[model samples]
Target: MSDPIEAAIFEKLAKADPKNVGGKSIEPADVAKELQPEQWQRMLPKVKATALGLMRQGKLTITKKGKVVDPNNFRGVIRLRLPTEAETAAALAALPPVESSDDDFD
Candidate 1:
């Protein structure tokens, strides 16, 4: 199984280039780059947020037992399983529609 934290860190370092991600196309610069100690420290929360966003968007989930759990609980060094179509649909449907804060503007 793949590691989600490594994947996300790869995504960040790779600048989200699809070509540089996955399989033989993987690049050393993609996942090899590491932030400075201080920067890496600051990035922990952002990394968690990104993981959560991916989960909420139904791209990934936490595998517990035989089912996927919400990725909101994904902590450090954990991998997230990709969600199925039905699971993604359910997740999307459960979310409230986006609201416009400027809707009342004249």
Candidate 2:
């Protein structure tokens, strides 16, 4: 598994965040961009694969293999939401206030 890509995959699966509310643990994609230059070059694909593995295990259910699945609805493109105050502000500022939607239940 010396191929950079495979190495990356291992790194991703080996180190992933685990705060998924739906019991689906966070996978490598969550930290894909965060990987160092060398790490990214090699492990990005791996992380993506790990993400898919999570989905395969039913830890997550999204269209894309390595992506954040909707917590409430798993039939669409769902990405992870940040919990930091900075992230909250960013998300809110990025979107117009949703009058009422089930997506915001979290």
Count of clashes, each model: 0, 2
TM-score of each: 0.45, 0.31
Q: Which segments of model 2 are wrong by more than 4 Å?
A: 1-30, 35-37, 63-106
Q: How well does model 2 score by local distance difference test?
A: 0.44
Which digits, one per residue and each the tens of the lDDT, describe model 2 over residues 13-97? 3444343333233334545655655555475555555444444434333333655444334543334222344433543455545
List RMSD in Å for every model shown. Answer: 7.9, 14.6
Best by TM-score: 1
Clashing pairs in 2: 8-43, 9-46
lDDT of each: 0.52, 0.44
